[model samples]
Target chain A: MPQTHDDVAETTPARADVVEMVGLHGFVQLAAFARLATDAEHAPDLRAQVTISRMAAGELAALDQLETVARRVGADLYEAMASYSTVLADFDRRTPPGDWWERVVRTYVAYGVLADLQRVLSRAVAPDGRPMLDDVIADSGYEDFVVAMLGPVVAADQQLSARLALWGRRVVGEALGIAQRLLAEHPLLWSFADRQDGARSEGDDAAWLRKQLSGGHARRMGRLGLTA
Target chain B: MPQTHDDVAETTPARADVVEMVGLHGFVQLAAFARLATDAEHAPDLRAQVTISRMAAGELAALDQLETVARRVGADLYEAMASYSTVLADFDRRTPPGDWWERVVRTYVAYGVLADLQRVLSRAVAPDGRPMLDDVIADSGYEDFVVAMLGPVVAADQQLSARLALWGRRVVGEALGIAQRLLAEHPLLWSFADRQDGARSEGDDAAWLRKQLSGGHARRMGRLGLTA
Candidate 1:
């Protein structure tokens, strides 16, 4: 469960949990992308793809901070993270990429959605934790790489564009579903959702997050020459 | 075909080809190890393991040099590399590691052999190309990480040590077999062996390389509490 509070002292440990969960998830996602970037068949530019992955590894610096925070608060980082594997793994399982184009779209779309959510959620974290979160999500490093690699292929094949656009929507759908499940299962997240500055309801947060996710996804699709 | 020469000017392009072949092979080996490092099941420490993989990625810096060299000479880097793929892929196919310990041992042993051979062969390259080749092989970053990870595990289980030692030998066998195939198929390499300074024969270089490979493997086994 991940929750954030304005009164930082009282909810310090939970905030740390929130950060660890986000940071660990980011690392896991980036690591998977790093592996996929090595797929010579599907990757647009192996060098640029690898570059994006190394940049993704840059997020590990923030992961270090979150892990430290988790330790200081006596949180069992692994135990706290155990619940996430199911949802995250489910997202991967449901939307397995069949080839290189699918890989590019899935990576670009899913990571974009997660990055967007992390950006919105970072505001709820305590001040110390927020900056690092911001840094992790700040640079969408692979966006141009995806466009450059996949754009031409999509332009050449109408069938691929349609398939990829559908793939992009599926990723957004799956990611949002996981986020919803995450919010529901974790009390910390529920509190974070419920206890934000004003009386914004969970539905409102979900809607806002969804808007951001779709906006990002649409822009990414546009970049890759796939219609939203 | 990639060949080296004492006469620097005429053979400059061939020297570059030779460097690209070796550099690209090293990059491919490192890239494969990078993927294996992400396997949490066998890796002793995920963070340290990933660090080693990233260090492996650092080998790509030499890859950039090789690409430059290949382009300057109008050599198709991939085309020149096509012949060696069989041997390289065969090595991987035959010596797949089943667990984390095996992964560490295989990666360390196989990479050590390649790095050692690269070190020996780098001497034949023109002066300008030698430094980058040397830099790529110099650190052996993952060796320390493997010893730190596997030493205690093997100490706890004698049977594991025995298994790893056997595994180490198999990796060496497969690697040497690949090298033989690579030398036989590539004229540049045959020339490299045949046309080196008149005093030495191909048998001498091969024997010297074998000694270095075996000695390094034996020492690594001892470090890991395994009998050579």
Candidate 2:
């Protein structure tokens, strides 16, 4: 969903802001990874916990590289990050994990949705930022971690599966709510929505984003034995 | 603080447990890094925040390597992790960061002391785990980040400096308290203290640990422009 507007190359300042937003998302990934790494009760299996933590740590390293990309393009990393912190923090507050299983599901679903957005943003942004964004997107190695942990849990516990299915939906709801809030507040981000839809209105952009995010969320939930 | 006891080579199971402890500490590092990476308000300065987070992330990578070493020595990573979780969590809870500055100081000081302990433990454990421990200890790169952030803050603000100096002392106090408790609860951890002190009493081991940790803490504090 990339726009090949030649002027896109000239928009480094704005694109840098977008790169910082990606970095901010990197922090979110780091936070989720940290939660998984330290959730002792839910993650009783040390091997699994370590495995997940390493994956999360790998994401942070990728974010570190992305920050470097932002700096090279003259992005005000702190200012860009500050603008979106409240929306993300609120989203996290509304979607606190209930248990170990819920934590894994949340990590899986949230990253999946964010990766979809990143995939679009990586393409819509300036080319310099594109490669870094691509690397950051490719760092979505949590799929194996999620399947290994949740596949068996869902198979064994039908009641737990039902609960998690509902939980997964709530996560999607909260995430979309946050995504909508982000788009509404940061009209700049709407550029991604617009470029993807070829000069669409904000309303259409929101609808498109919802469809895009929800479709990905449904596929991810199905994989995890949860109803979207 | 290493002893040259030849018997140190024969304790593979015990050594394996120690390696797992290293992995658990890696999670502690991961958790702390995640908190800093996500602490939007306190970490207002993006450069310092990202710098410290990168350091913490690096520690997790080192721990991943250490886990491989543990496996090589037949250590049960999860069991070892479970046993030490309480001690590390208690240390973290009691020394909770009051603000962003406290967060940085806490990470710097705890890791410094742990590196020292790991230096001793790495040698005391089997040779298989020694090289990994050496790498883990060598990964203590927060020194520059701490100096860069705290040095200026302390140089500019005397009141803040005094507050953080005292805070640094409290972090050390809480950390040593946890170390002593671990030594008491897990008699095996006492082996490190014992190897250093030639069968000294618990009181003496505690004193030695205090001395060791305090000396390193003072050096770190001085470097950061905080009072020892």
User: Runs in model 1 with CA error above 4 Å?
Assistant: A1-83, A124-134, A138-140, A187-199, B1-33, B37-49, B68-83, B124-134, B187-205
Most DockQ-accurate candidate: 2
lDDT of 1 by residue, B1-228 (tens): 122233443345556446445534545543543444344323444455346645544544454444555554556555555445445556767887888778778777777766655554554345554332335444646778778877898888988878888988888888766555555455354333323445266677566556766787778778777877
How accurately is candidate 1 docked according to DockQ?
0.21
Candidate 1 CAPRI-style tier: incorrect
Worst ten in a row by lDDT for model 2 chain A: A1-10
Error of 2 at B107 (Å): 3.2
DockQ of every candidate: 0.21, 0.31
Residues A79-133 of candidate 1: C-alpha lDDT, one tens digit per residue: 4554555565577779888987786677777777766556555544464554223
The per-prediction CA RMSD against the true structure, in angstroms, equals 5.7, 5.2
User: Which pairs clash (backbone N, Cα, C closer than 3 Å) in model 2?
Assistant: none
Question: Could you give me the TM-score of model 2 versus the true structure?
Answer: 0.80
Candidate 1: the clashing residue pairs are: A2-A188, A2-A189, A3-A188, B42-B100
- Angstrom error of the Cα, residue A182, model 1: value is 3.3
Q: Compute the interface RMSD for candidate 2.
A: 4.3
